[model samples]
Target: MRSDTAALTTITLPEIRLRVRDAHKLRGYFGELFREHSPLLHNHYEDGTFRQQYPLVQYKVLDGTPTLVGLGEGAALLVELFLRIRELDIDGRHYPVQAKHIEHRTEAIGPVAGLRRYRFETLWMPLNQDNHRQYQTQSAAEQQAQLTRILTNNMLALLKAVGAYASDMPLLLVHLLPGEPVVTQFKNQSMLGFMGEFVANIALPDGVGLGKSVARGFGAVRRVD
Candidate 1:
């Protein structure tokens, strides 16, 4: 891989620190998604920059469940996969995974206690328009089955980029901005956006926030073993 691309491919755990008027509110917010995704030790601030080694997409969960609106470029593909999974028209046979999936893996630790530990991966699944249309026509059972297959394949690809044991499972969070968000790209940094002067950034050092060297080392070992 090119140095830059290799750099980009590296996965890092996110660091977040949350401050709130009521600690229970904070726990309630994360507890909503605890069964499916994990929250690691991250810095908290009413307003400040998230510390990262690379530029990645960051979401501020003003609410518990992350909707699709929370994703930036760093998280777009994963969120897109989630959207595809949810677009299923059938009932009962939704994607085998649900919002509660991460909650099952949640744990309470020290100061950073009461959150889950999670891993993340990304995949690029190129599909033709014909398959897309066919996907739309399938029965709920068939559609969910297809989604399971597709999700598994995509997650495998994500593992190739990151690792197999990064997170317990995959979850999608969305943005709930009242209106359109303004996005700005930079020459040496991550993407930034604004929704009515409230800023949201998609920078790197993502995936539960591990450093580049450590991520690469883990990936290398996984590849060889």
Candidate 2:
């Protein structure tokens, strides 16, 4: 196992009541406002090409409040811009920011002795276009197995992006707690999303996102146990 440390910072506009669906708008607003800072803010290059890297700064709406999470270098960027975020201008509507809460932490990323349970505070999108068709044909048990594999792969990618890579890491288990997967819209296309808790022998910090469209707050998880 490779020992790695990640710096994480979370900023929440506690007084703002933004709908979860408008998270992309938040991304758009900040991406444009701070376009000169770095491409990680919006995951786009100056020439309009997509940066094929893990998104370090992610936008999310947790519990009806606008939340922004930054990891690694992204954490530093958020800290630098923390004080300047005074309000949000979404579609010409001015929403004044009343109060904000920020939390910063450095977490170790590696295998843990025991599994940690985490709940999906936001929807977890596990399938992409190619796999979506296959997922539709699988049995319930097979579907669960496939999703577990995808979740594990997602974790590996996240760890690698954060400078930790463990080829012999312990198995990760995803238990879909008693509910049917919900269909949601992502980038104007319908997609399936899961809402449940997962257990993994990895030390993932709270507010880290997983799976697809995470930059838009698709798979936000918080430690529940």
Candidate 3:
């Protein structure tokens, strides 16, 4: 007879996700949540380094329910914060999300080569000194070039910070998927940041986020397949 564990495969989740009821009502600054329950993390990681090293602990309202996600190091923080805080109140409603009760799926890592195309629901590529002059009149090709450079830098940084020594720079390709990109609407302005599809030449594990403001609900992406 085959051992029960013989075929078991380990799924290295690129991100850890948790669910909360009445997720749509969750509001207020993400910094507040960390400061209140995970103060040390707030002071050391969340303040700045986190945005560079890992995606911040973030929540999103999907299907009318709130979902909490941790990326890379943020995963550990998510688990700890939920356990310590037990329940939290954001905006005005209460969320009884506990680490024990938090839900997750047993997953197995898939081929890194298979994960190429990705869809971004929100992507905010910030202005940099290098490209500040091209902000207004940049052509589509130029914009793509800038994005590729920025993305390459961020990924390399993540690998270095995590001490993943074999990161010889995975192949990456950027392009826009044919369709209307999502636009962010504000009371006074309408901004269309980076939102589209990316086809990487290498395996980018599922749940890898890119660009800027990923912690605050921008630049969240998943493998298209």
Candidate 4:
């Protein structure tokens, strides 16, 4: 009998769920992709670093009656290609998969606020493949471009699954840096020490001042650290 006691490594990706005026259309589009990418059973190592053994593809739906939509083998093939394209060596580099979730606010708030609210929860998981020192050596532009690429790729893939075009939405990303208190909360919950450097943001579509207003409300959190 095989022991089911494999070490568990959790990587939380908090995504900013963009609003689609047509939810039914969006669901029909991504339903296929979700079914394809999520593995019925995943196997990986728990060494707390990025090894070749870490599974690169994963999927789950939360807080809504959203269905699991995957493109099966087609998505698997894409994942394989994505891995090849990335070819990110873990031996001395660190990257994080930060998820951002955005939702519409039914109730209204302060003066001149839009009818939507964007809530961002950033979960940071360090890649042990590379030393932190080596990873920070890149120019700021290089770092932001790389981070944007990783994030946009995932977003595009998910959007493709749902049959929606991100080009239509025109995402305005506001990157954020965490403060000491927020870091403390994450450390307590995740048992992983916070680096105090994670790309978290509250994104808003056009015609919305909610994200901006929220950013002003939380003054301590810097745009970038």
Ranking by TM-score: 2, 3, 4, 1
* lDDT of all predictions: 0.26, 0.86, 0.46, 0.27
Write down the TM-score for model 3: 0.61
Backbone clash numbers for all candidates listed: 45, 0, 3, 31
Model 1 C-alpha RMSD vs. true structure (Å) is 20.3
Residue 45, candidate 3: Cα error in Å is 6.3
Each prediction's TM-score versus the true structure:
0.23, 0.93, 0.61, 0.26
The C-alpha stretches of model 4 lying farther than 4 A from their native spots are 1-122, 125-134, 166-225
Q: In candidate 2, which residue pairs clash? A: none
Worst 10-residue lDDT window for candidate 2 reads 170-179
- Where's the lowest-lDDT run of ten residues in candidate 1? 216-225
Write candidate 4's Cα lDDT for 1-225 as tens digits.
111111111122233232222222323333233334433212223443322322222222222211111132323433333322211112233323243222222221111212222322222232122433443677766655544444344334333433333354445243423223222222134222122333422221211111111111111112232
How close to the true structure is residue 209 of candidate 2, measured as C-alpha lDDT? Answer: 89
Top of the candidates by lDDT: 2
For residues 61-104, write the lDDT of model 3, one tens digit per residue: 43234455554455556665554544556656565643333533
Task: List ranges where model 2 is wrong by over 4 Å.
Answer: 1-3, 168-178
Question: Which tens-of-lDDT digit does each residue in 136-186 have in candidate 1?
Answer: 688866654554454344333333343222343333221211123223322
Model 3: residue 188 alpha-carbon error in angstroms: 9.7
